[model samples]
Structure formats: structure tokens, C-alpha cells
Target: MIAHNNMKSSPRLENEHEHENEPNNLIMKKLLSRCWEESRLLWRLAFPALLTELFQFSIGFVTTGFVGHLGEVELAAVSVVENILDSSAYGVLFGLGSALDTLSGQAVGAGRLERLGTYTQQSWIICSATAVALTPAFVFATPILKSFLHQPPHVSRVAGPYARWAIPRLFAHAMNIPLLMFFQAQSRVWAVTAISGAVLAAHVALTYLAVRRLGCGLRGAAVVGDISHWLIAAAQFAYMRGGCFPEAWKGFTVRSFSNLGAFVKLSLGSAVMIWLVVSIGYGSLEFWYYTTLLVLVGLLKHAKLQIDIMSVCLNYEFMTIMVALGFSTAAGIRVSNELGANRPKETKLAVVVAVSTSAFMGAIFMAFALIWRTSLPKFFSDSPKVIDGASRLGYLLAVTIFMSSIWPVLSGVAVGAGWQVPVAFINVGCYYLVGIPLGILFGFRLKHGALGIWMGMLTGTFLQMAILLAIIFRTKWEKQAELAKMRISEWGGKNENQPLIS
Candidate 1:
């Protein structure tokens, strides 16, 4: 067996590649072995991440569900408000925090444990500032919706107040993301999952009692959601500072504040990547069209005509969001780890495994969506008209889920590769220039409606995926590994010969 740790030089990596052309059976065996190894690593990080995201996603869903029970008006209000958060502030700050992942993930791979805390601290500062900058948008969400969107009276009335009530979550998410990235880098996601589980349980009870028992209406649900976010942030902050991962924490440092330029630049890139990925279609026109549909349904008072369709859209989004979150995390971590360790070939291999796995999962989602089309909407609504309407859109939802399954991992790859800046431009071109305009042309000009909007989204997603795949395939992995090493060295501290904290 080749000694990976000792084989760090250029010649060794070249020799490793030379072996790629070994007899077909030998190559196949090597590939299979790698697949198994990569799969285990990916799944460990992914499963917990999946649950954590679900728990996070559920906070909004639970609130929406409780609010949904009150009336369609309330449901529509909360939904609009929730999407307001999702499509804007949340994505930008989360992206800024994700900058820590690139630094910390590679730090872990390079055994520079102390730098993890430094990156985490820097991320916290950046994310908090970004969140503060975005707070006014949340504050004015309703007016913007009312004035800009020209929403109906009922939706416009409640949406603003509900957004104001939930404003605390914006800050909670800011603090939460740095901690989450810090922990994920060390493969300590179980901590997040456990915390998320406890938070989720508390959230469910809070939403139930606050909405149903206390009759707090939208205000109650919004307040509870804010509380959940803060609680998670506080718990994680305390745990990490207390004793968790002592090597990584090092009780905080002034060093974090020292090299502002590099960190800030990286954070901006990371923020742009997050902002683009989260807001692209999920938060952009795809969201726009869905919002338009809901408004049309509510305005026309044709709830019966579109309830099932909305339900289908919700379920599709739920499934797609979680799966995308899971795979994206997997891909980023896997690539970052291998790149840091200077295993360029293995880094490429990891991307292949992660993307393939995600694609396969997408296919499975597509199949299930198709198979269970008729029965699926029952979970969201019981009305026969709603159910029938949902059935008609089920196939379309399946196609959407398939896209959701693939693109996020590609986004993750860009994150891991530290190409967030360039990729942000790609995201804009594919999603806004290509996808959104196309959707409008088809959905409105050509009369495709929701399906047309989705087609535009799918086209954007496919283009994004293809472009990302092209970048991955054509990348010179060895140079990336080398760059990672240089970065860790630069970030670690003064003395080059000193042992890494790990």
C-alpha cells in the first residue's frame, strides 16, 4: 500500500496517477474500494446534517402548519413572511459563516486545530455584522411586500407584523452558523444533531401551545421560532466554549482579528456563494412564481382550485431542500478534507462519489414522487379538489426534486474548492440570466405557468450542474491541495516549524 502520509511530494502524486492505468480489474477493485471508503465518510457527515437541516426546516414548517390551521389567510401570511426571511437575510449571513467551513475543513485536514477556532471567531464577527446590515430588510419586509408586491389586503396586513415578530431569528441564525461550521469541520455534527433534536422537540411544543392553546396566532408562532434559533445558538456557544474540542477552541484569541484582509475577502466570496445558491431559484423566481400562484389563488378566492397544487409544491420543496442540504454538506467536507491532506487524486475521487450518490438519491426521489403522486398530497390537505389538483402537478414536482437532488452538491464542490467568488458569477448567469428569464418567457409569454417556471428552474439547475461538473472534472487537483497547504501554513501562526495544534 502506498503510504499516503509520507507520499507528499510531486513525484509521489505523479506516480499515484500513473497507476490509474493498471489492468482493468485492478482499477475497478481500487475504484470500488475507494467508493466504499468515501461512502462511509460522506454518510457519517451527511445523515446528521440531514437531520439537523430537517429540524431547522421544520421550525418554519411547524409554524406554517399551526398557522395553516387558523385559516388560509394566516397560512399565506406566514408563508410569505417565512419566504421573505429565507430568500434574503438568512442566505447572505449563512453564506458568510460558511466561509469558516473552507478554512476549518482544510485546517482539520492539515492538522491545524487551533486555526479552527480562529476561523470560527472571524466568521462570527462577519456574520453578525452582515446580519445587522440585513435587519432593516426584515424590519421592512411587509411594507416591501405591500408596496412592491402589491399583495392582497389579508396577506399584506398580517405578513408585516409576522415578519416583525420573527425578526430575532435573523440574529440567532447569524450566531448559530459559525458554531455549526466550526463543528462540522471536525466531523462533530452529532453535536448539532442532538441539539437540533432537543430544539425541534421544544419548538413543536412551543408552536402547539403558543398557537393552539395560548391563541397567539401568527405572533406566537413567530416568537417561538425566534426563541428556538436563539436557544440553539446559546447552547452551542456554551458547549463549544466550555470544553468541546479543546484543541480547536483554544479559548479564543486576538489573532483572529489580526489578518482582516484575507479573512474578509474569503468571507465575502463565501457570502456571495451562499447568497447566490440559497436565493438563486429556491429564493428567487422559483419562489416568485410560487408566491404568485398562492396570491392568485387567495385573491381569486379559488382556494379549492389551487390548495392541492400548493400542497404539492410545499412537499416537493421540503424533500428537495433537505436532500440538497445533506449532499452539499457531504461534498464540501469530503473535498475539503482530501484537499487539505494533499491527496489530489482522492479529492477528485471524493467529488465523483458525492455527486454520483446525490444523483442516485435524486433519481430515487423522482421515482417515489411519481409512484406516490396521488397519495402524497393527503398529508398536507384532505380536500378532494386539493388532492386532485396536486395529482396533476405531481410529475412536475418529481422533475423538480430531481434537480434539487443534484445541484446543491455541485454548489458544495465550489465551496470546498474555494471558488465561491467565480461560482457566484456562474450562479447569477445560470439562475438569473438564463433560468429566471426563461421561466418568465415560458410561464407567462408562452403560457406554461408553474410548470414553465419549473422548467426554467430545471434548465438553470441543469446548466449549473453541468458547469460545476465541468469545473470539477477539469480542475488541477494537485495544485488545489498545494494551495490548501500553503493557506494552512500562512494561517497557523508565526513559526513555520512549529507543530500544528492538533
Candidate 2:
């Protein structure tokens, strides 16, 4: 009778164990299903964004390729203009536009779609003014290059003309950047990609005709680029007015100009609540970091050849980094939208998928850089020395690409959370204080040249990435969601009954 009782107890215990494991297995399955869904949404935004970036960056890339074969002086001159001057302008404008990524995305998540059109219009006002202010810089670029920076005279002369011709593109950006953010907030990414592809195809043919077949040289290339940008902006505007976004876009309104003082204050405020100006600052700092690198390269002996080699490497860097930026853009949209929707877990999952996908893309590019180090530079140049110098720096470029892949995604996360102010500070500390100083030491003091400068900058990037990781690790997503709700409530109460006219 005792033995029979023991056997019965063993079976009961085993059955109890099975019952406990079932809930755990169910939870695991649920989590996996959510992860799969999050990944699908992320790619829907990311893949189109990636292609758009590729096409956009290819505009300059193709121009550089064409200019390179013209002569070394033309190549060097265009490099300075495009890399330093154009980059500075693009950085600030892009940064300003980033504000909309956060605001409009959150607005959509909160179901306040009407706010997007107004926010976009306000952005257009500010960005247009800023673009106008930036014009004199491009117009007088030669003097600044020669007098302040002491670039070679021939390079300056060519670059000056090119800069002047590139001015229209700035205004075009002012019109288009707002539209891009407006569209991305609503996941209208495929439209943007299609426009980019069409513009790029047209641009390639026109640029080829103007620069090569027509013998129009740098001026023609610049003019063609300017036209391409205008075309893109016009196309976007046409789309916005086509009644697809009836809920979000009720046509343009005078309300976009009302409360101008408050809007400016919010855009440029130093407080944590402010995002636009801080995003701009971060954008400027991030882009000017590379521009500063180019300046340092200019100061070196054998400046022209160094510029050529560095330019090729930088162009490739730009191309690969754009892929990461696509991921960055999607991350920003996803995180902000999820936070607005009060889904912190979904936001967290979105971050994971975005970072992982971008990292994989970066790895693929890195391997390509390593394997085809010698062959890659030929696409940009015919000069043997330029090709060889670039190839020698290939390993450094690979590392930079990988680091770039990770950090931009992290920056996107910060932007989504409205943490641009702190990240802007981080950028200054890392890129300016640490990276620039170390670069000077390595490039001039220790005689490592352009390679050393890049390595030092790479160090700064690594530090920035690590610090961002720490910040993300400690972030309270629930609190962020609360803040998003608060922000939407404050801004979403205005101009509901206004008459909007396109």
C-alpha cells in the first residue's frame, strides 16, 4: 500500500511540472510573433528609405566621377566645394528638417494628423529664411577658401564658380526637406523613393549631356544638379496637393504663420522641450566634422593629391553611410510614432530591428571595402597615385563604415526621444575636443598625413557610439511616452477650424 501511494504522488508531481511549462512556452511564442511583426514594419520603411538615400547621394557621386576625369584641378576644386561648403549647408538644413521627423511622427501616432501640414509649413518658412541667409556663403566661396582657409588658388577659382552655380539647390532643399519629413511621418516612403529614382535617372542623362557631350564643364554640372533638385521639390509639392493626405493635409493655411514668435522659441529653445534648433546644431556638428577633416587635409603638404585621395575615400564613405542613414531615418520615425502611440515595448522592438539591420548592411559594405580595396577607387579616379592612396586607407575606411552604421542609428533613437540637445553636446565633445585634437597630433606632429587624421576622427566616432549606447541602455521608455503625450496635447490644440488654401 505504501509503494502504490509513492507511484501515484510521482505522476501528480510530473503533471504539475508540465502545467507550469505551458504558460512559459506560450509567452515565448507570443514574443517571437511580435518581433516578426515589428521587423516587417521596420523594413517597409527602411528599404525604400535606403534606396532613396542611394539615389540622392549618387547625384554628387556621379558628378564627382565625371569631374574627376576632366582634370585633377577640377576634381580637387569640386571636392572642396561639395564636401566642405555644400556639406555645411546640407547639414544645418537637414538637421532643421529632423525636427519634423520627431514632431510629425509623434503627431501621427497620437492621431493628430492635422498638425503635420501646419508643422511642415512652419518648417518651410524657417528653412527658406535660413537658406537665403546661407546664399552669400556660396556666392563668395572663393574668397573664403583662399583668404580664410588658404586652399590652393586654382582649386579655389574652380570651386568658387561651382559654388555660385549650386546656390539654387539650396532653395530647392528648403522647399523639399519639409515635404520629406511630412511624408515619412505617414510612411509614404515609396512615393519619395519613386521620385528620387526618376529624378536620378533624369539627372544622370542631363549631367552626362551637360558635362561630357556638351563640353559645359563644372558650371554645366552645377546647373544640372540645381535643376534636378528643383524638379524633386516640385514633384513633392504636387503630390502633397493631390488630396492623398486629406486628413493630415487640409491645404496650406495662414495659421502656419500665426504664433510665429512661439514657434521660433520652440524651434530654437535651449530647454529639453526644444528639438528643432538642437537637431540643427547636431546636424551641423555631425556634418562639419567631416568638413573640418577636409580643411585639415587642405593644410597638409601635397594638398592637391591628398585632397583627391581623401575625397575618393570620403565619397565612398558618404555612399555607404547613406545606407545607415536610411535606417536612421526609419528608426526615428518608428520610435517617435510608437512613443506617441504609447507603445514603449513596440518602440524598443523597433530600435532592435533597425540597429540590427543597419549593422548587417554595414558589415556587407565593410567586407566589400576590404576585398575590393584596390579596385573601388578606380571608379572615382584615373590617377594612379590617388587610387593607390585611397586603397592604402581602405582598412580605416572599413572601420569607419562599420562605426557609422551603428552610431547614426543610435542618433536616430535619440532624436526620436527628443534628446538632440544632449547628443549635440556629445557630438561637440567627441568630434571637436577629442577627435580634432588627436587628429592634429597624428597628422602633423607624428607625420601620418590624411590617414592619421581619419583614424583620430574614427576614435571620436567610437567614443560617441559608446556614450550613445550607455544613454539608450538607461532610457525609460515609459517616461518618454508620457512626454510625447504631453507635447502633443500642448501643440495639437491650435487652428482646428482655420480655412486652409494651397
Candidate 3:
């Protein structure tokens, strides 16, 4: 009887183990399916932003094409000055605005509606102060430009008007970015898309009026660009104040110095990282243009014209980058929200979706870049030499685009997860230590020209992406949530033991 009882108990234990394994297998399958679904969701969220980015690029290309008709000197001056201003001002504005997606996403996840408003208000104050501080740089534009580039007397003459007219645009962007960020954090992405579209339309109208009707030449174009930004900012403000974002706009007090300090502490690393990468990368290209190519090859040559054509290509590159950034922003928001809600599995799914979708987008961009290599430059200019040069670089740029797509998405994931410090450090290491140095050596020292510089930058980007990928794979979302709670407590002035997520 005792032997019989033991045999019966052994079968029951085995049956129980099989029942447990069945549920575990089902959970695994569900997770895999969720990851795929999340990718589709990210694509849906990012597509409008991508369309907006393309529209913005069209505006830039149109501006450049118009300026190109004036002559090579005008084209060169516009390219150089625009690059500098964009790297300094726009880069900072974008970086600061990214903080909104980071903080507000988590706040929303934690069900802290009031905190979202506070974050938006704080971003405006901090970004506005930064804009004020940056104004002096514009005041000293000529001297600053001369310090970097061997600006020929004629180039300096044209660049002066362009820089002066364009400088104030940065201040306008300071306001616009924060407002856009607030909308984006709330997943009101269509608002920004509409605003950006309207801004671009206004810019086109103003560009035509300034250049053709008013005969302001490039100066008119610059002035119109600046004014359009202010118009966009005003429109966004009206929309927000007109009851679209009443909850986010309520109790809006000017941020105290302490709050600003805290915001800066959270944001400066990412800002510095972006600034350094953009500045150094553009600076390297400009240095190559002035030192190596511009002097050796005159404007009449195929090479010189090709260099001008590359500017148009660069605009397309920017569009691709912005698309990637859009998805990254969405990923960051989703991941942050899930983490804040203490849904580790969901956060992991969001990250997987972001990375995979970015990879697919990168592949698509690469295909387009390759297919359109010959015809792309013709859209901007009539020169065959320019088109050929652009085609050669276009192939390489496609790879860069694909690689870059992964970066913003993965970086966004980290940002949403509050891994900014680590990501910032990785950027510094890859971009500054590896990318810049290699680009300088290849472009200037080895005289490989623009292609060499791009190769170096691409290598650095690849390394940075790799590091971020490793971090994402190894991270424990549960632990991240605990840390986030601690941070929220510190920020909200709550007890250490207080749970922010619940």
C-alpha cells in the first residue's frame, strides 16, 4: 500500500510541473507578439513627424536652391553660416526640448498631471535664459565667423547680412521648441506637425517676398526665416492658451532659479553632448572646405560645384535624421511611461520595438539614397560634376543614415529610462575622442576630403550606438523604476520612502 501511494504522488508532481511550463511558454509567445505590435505602434506615432521633417527639408532645399542661383560665393556663404548657426542654436534648443519628453512621459505614466505642466513651464524658463545668454554670440557674429573660417572678404560681406538677419531666429526657436515639446510629451504630435507645416509655408511665402518682391536678396530670406519662427511660436502659444492644453498650461509660474538649476543639471549633459558632436562635425567639414578644397579648386571647376551640391544632399540627410529622432522621441515617451507605471515587461517591449523599427526605417532610407543618387542633385542644380560628386558621397551617406537611425531611437529609449548621464558620456567618448580626431586626421591631415570626414563620423556613431545597445540589453527596468522613484521624490520634495509610481 505504501509503494502504491508513492507511485501515485510522483505522477501528480510531474503533471503539476507540465502545467507550470505551459503557462510560461504562453507568456513568452505573448511577449514576442507584443514586441512586434509595439513596433507598429511606434511607426504610427513617428510617421507624421517624419512627414513634417521632410517638409522642413523641402523648405531648406528651396532656400538653398534660391541662394545658389545668386552665385557660388553666395551659396558657400549661406552654407557655412547656416551650418554654424544651426549647430549652435538649433541643436541646443532641440536638446533642451528633449527633456520634456523625458520628464513629462514619466509624469503622465505616474498619473501626475500637474507635474507635466510644471515640467513644461520649467523648460521654457531654462531655455529662454539660455537663448538670452546666446544672444551675445550673434552680436559678435563676424568676429566669431572669421575666427573659425578664412572667410574671404566677399564671403564675409555676404555672410555678415545672413548671420545678422538669422541670429534672432535662435531666440524664437527657444520659445517654439518648449511649446512643441509639451505637445509631443502629451502625444499631441499632430499639433506640432501642423505648426511646423504652417511655419514652413509662411517661410516659403516670406522667402519669395523677401528675395523677389522686396529685393532684400539673401538678407530678406534671412529676415523672413527669423520672423516666421516668431509667428510659429505665437500660434503655438495661442493654441495652448486657447484651451487645447489647459491642464498643461494651468498654474504656470515662472520657474524659480533653483528649479532652473535643477533642469540644467538634468539637461546640460545631453546639451553639451549634442553641441560638441554637431560643432565638431560641422567645424571639421568647414575646415576641410576652406583649408583643402576651396583654395585648390576654383568655383568654375566640377569639384567646387560638387561641394555646393553636397549642401543639398546634407539637407536630405537632416530630414532622414529627424525622422529617426521622431521615432526615438516616441520610444522614449512610451518607455518612460511604462517604467513609471512599473511595467517592466512593457518597457522592454517598447525598447525592442523602437530598435527594430528604426533598423527597418534605416534600410528603407538606404535604398532610396542609392536609387536616387544620380537624379537627386539635378533637383537642386544643373551641374553634372556636382551631381557625380554628390552621388559618390550619397552611397556613403546612405550607410550613415541607416546607422544614425538606430542612434536616436536607442538614445531616446535610454533618455526615457533616465539614462542620460551614461548616454551623454558615451557620446563624448565616441564623438569627441574617436569621431572628431579620426575625421580631422582623414579630412585634413590625410587629405581624403569630405568623404573621409564622413567616414570618421560614421565610425564614431556606430560605436556610440553599440554602447547604447549593450546598455539597453543589460538594463533591469524594475531597478530603473526604483531609481526613478527616488529621483521623483527628490524633485517633488517628498519623503525618501514615498512611492511616486503608486
Candidate maximizing lDDT: 2
Q: Against the true structure, whose TM-score is highest?
A: 2
In model 1, the Cα lDDT at residue 94 comes to 59
Judging by TM-score, tell me the better candidate of 1 and 3: 1
Candidate 3 residue lDDT tens string, 151-258: 444655666768777777777777777776677667776776787788888788878877877877888777777777677788778787778766666755554344
In angstroms, give how far residue 194 of model 1 lies from its true place.
1.2
**TM-score leaderboard ranking:** 2, 1, 3
Clash count for each candidate, listed in order shown? 0, 0, 0
Q: How much is 238 displaced in model 3, in angstroms?
A: 1.2
Question: Which residue pairs clash in candidate 2?
Answer: none
What do the candidate models score in CA lDDT, each in turn?
0.73, 0.86, 0.68
Off by over 4 Å in 2: 1-15, 270-279, 494-502
TM-score of 1: 0.85
List model 1 lDDT by residue over 416-501, tens digit each.
77776677667668766887778777766776665666676668767877897898889999999998888777656446334332
TM-score of each: 0.85, 0.95, 0.84
Q: Model 3, residue 27: what's the lDDT? A: 90
- Candidate 2 residue lDDT tens string, 1-502: 9999999899899999999999999999999898898888888888898888888888889899988989888989999999999888988888877667778888888888988888899889988998999999999999999889888877898899999999999999889888988888898979889999999999999989999999999999999999888988999899998999999898878888884445655567535444543756786777888888888999999999999999999999988878888888889999999999999888888888888887888899899989999998998789999899999999999988888788888988887877877888888899889999999999999999998898888888889888988888777899999998887777665457432210
